[model samples]
Target: MAENNDLASGDDILASYHLPSPKPLWLNAVYARHIVRGNFMALSARPPTVDMGEWVAHQVVEHWRMLVTFIRLVHDKDETGHTICNGRTCPKMSAGPNHSFTWLNSRLEPVEIPAYEYLSLVQRYISTKIDDAAVFPNDPTGVSFAPYPGASSSPSSPPNSGGGSGPDWVGRRSGFPQNFLDVCQKIFRQMFRVYAHLYWSHFEDPLYHLGLEKSVNSCFSHFILTATTLDLLGPADLEPMQALVDLWAANGTFPQDSRAYGYANLRAGERLLALAGATTAV
Candidate 1:
């Protein structure tokens, strides 16, 4: 288990800038858990370990720090403004009003939940896959199925010299490595299918429910800034991820368009920073 820091204790971090702490520590934990679980599942090739609790705690801390930094930047601007409520009455506001209890707007208010909820959701998905292992079938036959004699052997061996005591090639060499190409093609297809399923099941559904086009666009901008801080992503990856976020944000696929989008972008920024820190230490 990880050490529990008072969520409210981070007020000092928020004080460094002119922004209010968005919510209590517990709510931050919930958001952190959801973002970490999604990221872990996307990146992990194998099942996660039992030490996930510790990982969750660490992720929550990192996420909180990222949130603080983001709030500071958004409020750091010196632009003041007024809104005409009834088209005749002006409500005065500065760029960084102390009365601003909400983040960006009322629609972007943070949620209150523990981080464990997200961990449970990820575990459930993994468990479902484990229970359905039979869906991923392999060949039962022991036959070599090599395209040519000794082709199934390691690459260290000479190619198709026919020195091995295996089945004879019927005069014509097997169709220009058809079996090798077939296996490669099959593996590629399986990988893509799995990626599509997981992406849709985890990310697409939530985005669709959230109506997040604008938020995602904002995330793209945040990604640029955060990526610079972390130094893990280059222009190639950043550009594409930004484009994807923009597409989704514009399409209104994020939940709670204002809040969800900002929060999600904040989480991504946190992950980038963490990655950079880890890389630097290495």
Candidate 2:
């Protein structure tokens, strides 16, 4: 877990942000328990190890889930073939030039690209990839599927590779090569910008007006907490929306005060940390 700065205590932090209390996602508690008992208990009971590759794959799938969910909330209108919405639609998040988020390029130099421009790139990327269901079939019995070979990072964002199946823990094992793991990391880093722009720039009007804030905030909180738990996001990557993350975290939506909150899954998956020599505690 990232340490709190000399900033303040939990109470002060929440007050400073003037955020509301977070509701427990307990309405469907029984539903979750049922799934775990039926599907996860046996597997979790056996081993908790997840290596770097599997970890990255897990992050990709989870982050993609959040990204797509939020994207669905957006209304796209384009007179041109391009569906890029400048700050006109989401003024809260519009960047100056082409309305792009500021990011450090591979050379570590700052670069900016419009949000709509990115949507085009990402949509193209997703549409071209072979869908996961087509590649990996569901099995009643657990089965291990190694990552597709020939997977490599694109020299640019919005990878050039036509991808493979979504991340899944094969039967009961976990591990991946460093290069493949890096690909997952890069994918997540870009996808996170998608979340940051939505939460920071356009959570009002349509998003909030449609009563989507609770769902969005809750989902974003989970993403933040999970990313932090796994050390998936560096401080620099998180800096853009760190303040909001801090606010939501303090409000109990994603409590950062306890190790328990830091790693909500540690109890069931301690062996993963053990294998990785990670010290993120429960």
Which prediction has the highest TM-score against the true structure?
A: 2
Q: Which numbered prediction scores highest in lDDT against the true structure?
A: 2
- lDDT of each residue in 21-110, candidate 2, tens digit only: 441121111111111111111211112332223434444565576668667555365456433356455433332122345545579886
> For model 1, how does the per-residue alpha-carbon lDDT over 106-160 read when each residue is reduced to its tens digit?
4766442222222223234333432342321222331122343323221212244
lDDT of 2: 0.43
- Candidate 1 accuracy as TM-score: 0.19
In order, candidate lDDTs are: 0.27, 0.43
**Which stretches in model 2 have alpha-carbon errors above 4 Å?**
1-52, 78-84, 87-111, 125-177, 255-282
Clashes of each: 15, 4
The C-alpha TM-scores of every prediction are 0.19, 0.52
Report the error of model 1 at residue 234, Å: 20
RMSD of each: 20.9, 12.4
